[model samples]
Target: MRIGILTSGGDCPGLNAVIRGAVLNGIKSHDFSFVGFRDGWRGVKEGDIFELPRHQVRGIAKQGGTILGTSRTNPFDGENGGPERIQATLDRLGVDAVIAIGGEGTLAGAKRLTDAGLKIVGVPKTIDNDLDATDYTFGFDTANQIAVEAIDRLRTTGESHHRCMVAEVMGRDVGWIALHAGMASGAHAILIPEVPTSMEQIFGWVREAHDRGRAPLVVVSEGFVPEGADAAFSSRGVDSFGRPRLGGIGEVLAPLIEENTGIETRATVLGHIQRGGVPTAFDRVLATRLGMAAVESVAARQWGTMVSLHGTQIHRVPLRAALDNLKRVPAERYAEARILFG
Candidate 1:
């Protein structure tokens, strides 16, 4: 069988590992030929691709980013897009099935195309860990580790200067990254979108930490909004998916904390750093397993399905079931972490 693969949405640490896993397993076990779409859905719409033999994907398990590259292009847009055009392109190229590795937007597109009779499988990919279908996604662990390391570094500088340091980590609609990183790094306070905190409450935490002869370390998710605010702070813009480009909450919170608590403060945005670099051992293994399972799904002719991690095992689930609702941080989980708050 001639199978096509594409990596979509924001680049993450375990992307290359997924490509390696799928290609190796497809070639070795199933004797299947593989090709990679160059830049997400755009490549598929334009029929731009390259051959993927065993040699092309060798030694890329620990590598960060993707060998096939990625983009935020919606497969339903443009004149050459939609399921009809995509299917025509696939027919011309003799591609039998597609394995899409990406976050929500990418999988949604795949689901739509599959409903139109396309053979496609999905592998969930998001550092936010917001997809409810899978117990855990691949890039979350690596991103959490990166955020924790950044907070640890910020702590030493904050102590030296006797200032409150606010670290912003990426979490658009969920606070998994910020919550795990803050708890792991021993942050004095952790702010997340699931819990809307008042500035007064944040100031109180900072003041309390300072009074205890400690440098206050605040970790916040990018999507976190103050209690009175109607939305998360976002002035940058929106992406192709029409979701607001969320960030700069740390920048907004830094001055407020300093002014309210009379303590010097600084903000550090750990932007794309969390998305790059070698993946953690946990992420590498998980991504690899998910990728191999995706190939198995393709062999089984499971269209409109996604490979998900259910506890220790990888299972295939319907695309509709996976995209039904975003997995959010439960209030109980946030409350448990709140116990460590200053």
Candidate 2:
């Protein structure tokens, strides 16, 4: 059977690994031929694609980004777009199935196409680990690991200058990246999008940390909203998919923190750095397994389903399961981390 694969949304650490895994598994086990769509849904809509043979995927497991490339292409745009157009394109190309590797928006679009009678399987690819169905996603570990290393490096500089360093990481609607990285880096405080943190509380934490003869370190998600503030200012703009850009929270918070606490504060936004790099060993393994499971789903014709990691095993679930709700940091988990706060 011939299959088509597309990677969508933002670039991720383990995206190349997933492509490699799928190509290797599908060819070796199922004797399947593969074609890759360029630049996400736009490629499918425009019929822009090329063959993705097994050799084309070699030595890419540790590579960052994707060989097929990606984009925030809206599948609902243009006169010749949406589910009907996509279905016709797949059928015309003689492709038997599709494997969509992306985050929530990409998966939702693919699900719509699937519901319209197209054969497709999904692989959850949120770097924030926000998808609720799976225990984890591939890029989150690599991103968190990168953030932790940056925090560790910044801690020394902050100590030398006696400054309260605020490190910002990505987490659009959740705090998984900040939470894990903060805990690992021994951050004095962690601010996330899910919790509305007040400037006064931030000041208290910095003051307490300073009194203990240590340079305070703060880790916050880019989407963090300060209490009684207008969501830490407006976003830059929306993407092609109409999702708002989430950032500048750290930059806005740092000044307020310094003014209120009388401490030198500096904000460092770790933008894009966390998302680009060789993936961690954990991420490589998980992404590979998820990719292989996606192939299995296609063989079973499990339309509108996605491969998910439940504990140590990979399983397939309905697309709705993955999109039911975002997996935000729970109160209890936050409380446990909060106890270590000032």
Candidate 3:
């Protein structure tokens, strides 16, 4: 069998591990040939690809990002794009199945192609841990670790200067990263998109922490909007996929926090840094397992299914099930996080 793989959306650690795992497992166990799509779905539409033999995947398990490259390009765009053209392109390449590794958008497109009669499998890839179909996604651990380290470093500086520090991590529509990182860092205040916090509440937390002789540490998701702040306040602009470039929420909150609490404040946006560098051991193993499971699903003809981590096992579920509800930080989890807050 000839299988093609593509990684789309934001780049994250452990992506290369997935590619390596799939190629090695498929070639060694199933006698499968592999090819990789360049720069996400645009490669599929434009017929841009390269051979992905088992030998080529050597020594890449610890590598960050993907060997196949990635982009936010929608597969349904352009003159030569869409299910029909993509089907023709795959047929021309003699590809039998496609494994799409990405976050929400990429998997949604893969689902569409499957409905259009193209054989496709999905692997969830989000640092946010937003997809509910799995216990956790591959990149979340690496990102959470990076965010916690940043907050820890910032905490010390805030202590020395007697200031309130606001550290923003990625979470465009949810607060999983900020929630975990903040709880892990013992942040005084944790703000996320799911919970709209008022400046009044933020000031209360900062003041209490200050009174307790602790540097006020605040963690906020990039998508978090303070109560009464306009939704457009966080928009930096949109990307090629029309997804807004989320930022400035931490910066905006810093001054408000300072003015309300009479304490000096600073903002640190932990932007792309959280998504880069070496993946944690957990991520590498999980991504590899998911990659292998994806190929297994393909061998079973489980089209439209995504390989997911449920408890200790790698399982398969419909792509729609994962997309139906994004796994946001629930109220209970946020409440537990608040137990650490002032």
For each candidate in the order shown, give its overall lDDT on alpha carbons.
Answer: 0.94, 0.90, 0.91
Residue pair clashes in candidate 1: none
- Candidate 3 has its poorest 10 consecutive residues by lDDT at 229-238
- What RMSD does each model have against the real structure? 0.7, 1.0, 1.0
Model 2 segments more than 4 A misplaced: 230-232
| Tens-digit lDDT string for candidate 2 (1-342) | 999999999889999888888988999999999999999988989888999998899999899999898998888789769888888888888888999999999999888888888888999997899997999999999999999999999999999999999999999889999999999998999999899987788889899999999999999998888888665454688767566777888888889889988899999999899989899999999999888889988888899999999999998899988888999999999999998886
Alpha-carbon shift of residue 96 in model 3 (angstroms):
1.0
TM for every model, in the order presented, reads 0.99, 0.98, 0.98
Q: By lDDT, highest first, what's the ranking? A: 1, 3, 2
Better of 1 and 3 by lDDT: 1
Off by over 4 Å in 1: none
Q: What's the lDDT for candidate 2? A: 0.90
Q: With candidate 3 superimposed using the best TM-score fit, by how many Å does residue 220's alpha carbon deviate from the native?
A: 0.2
Q: What would the per-residue lDDT of candidate 3 be over residues 173-196, giving only the tens digit for each residue?
A: 899999889989999999999988
* Model 2 quality (TM-score): 0.98
Candidate 1 structure lDDT: 0.94
> Which residue pairs come into collision in candidate 2?
none
Residue pairs in steric clash, candidate 3?
130-327
